[model samples]
Target: MDKFTTLTGVAAPMPLVNIDTDMIIPKQFLKTIKRSGLGKNLFDELRYEADGTEKPEFVLNQPAYRNAEIIIAGDNFGCGSSREHAPWALLDFGVRCVISTSFADIFYNNCFKNGILPIALPQDVVDTLMEDAGRGSNARLTIDLEGMKVVTSDGTEFPFELDPFRRHCLLNGLDDIGLTMEKADSIRGFEEQMATARPWI
Candidate 1:
């Protein structure tokens, strides 16, 4: 997972509320354990027509938002089934951060595990950011983890809160496996001691 320090990119506006996990990647695309290659299928149902053509009306399908790396989404985003693939798909699609007024708790934590920042701001602030996002690709937003704030293109800033442990994890690129790996020396010592104490067993 990439370390999330400071990210500056175009923010796509998605004001549709209650965007569930199924909407994020759809259940049909959940067969693969691998994280790569899901970007094309992300928002599959919304992004494509029945004939597999791109839907021009979709925010991501629009010319200016085609490469959006940040999303200012509606309330209760990521609110359904606890599919880890939702974050995987978002990450694959280059969306490193999602700002919403609120989020589902499970989905919120999953975002951190996969290196995507899920920001929850007041409705007023999110509304303002969504407007800024619609200002086109040049209105890039900057997320500064070290600074604990989101900066609009014009330098307007909104501070946010995150658990210290999660902040540490994102800053250091430490996933569950990475945290366990850091205890390798202690783990090895414990195994060695166990082996010596019970050779027959």
Candidate 2:
């Protein structure tokens, strides 16, 4: 996981609601436990044709959105199955933050763990950001996690709420394993004591 203090980059507008985990990476691509290389398969059904060619009509295939780092999406984003691959693909594709009116609970939690910032704002706020994202390459959005603000290219700022604990983890690049590693000394000590107390086992 990478630290996510601040990010300023292209924002792609995805207004479709109920973008499930399967849509993000598709079921066929879920066989691998590895997180890398999934970006190419991200939105496989929508981004690629049945012949495995790029879909020109897809938002991600558009030249302006090809390198989009932020996503302004519709309500109920990340709905459906709880597969963690969705966030992995998005992160690999360079999306550091996602701004939506709402998100599914499991997916929202997974984003934090995977170093992706999933922001929930009011519908009006999302609408404004979505419009800004539509301005093409000239319009860039800034997401400052420490400041909890998303600033549009035109200088409009919108504040969003995030759990303090999740914010701390992302700022420090700490995933579940990272969090455990933070208490390495204590864990080691506990193991030693257990070994000595139960030598027969």
In terms of TM-score, the best-performing candidate is 1
Prediction 2 TM-score vs. true:
0.96
List pairs with backbone clashes in candidate 2: none
Q: Against the true structure, whose lDDT is highest?
A: 1
| lDDT digits (tens) for residues 78-145 of candidate 1 | 99999999999999999999999999999999999999999999999999999999999989999999
Deviation in Å, model 2, residue 85 alpha carbon: 1.2
For residues 32-102, write the lDDT of model 2, one tens digit per residue: 99989999999899999899999999999999999999999999999999999999999999899989999
List of clashing residue pairs for candidate 1? none
Scanning candidate 2 in windows of ten residues, the lowest lDDT window is 154-163
Q: What is the C-alpha RMSD of each candidate to the true structure, in Å?
A: 0.8, 1.1
Cα-based lDDT at residue 64, candidate 2: 98
Task: Give lDDT for model 2.
Answer: 0.93
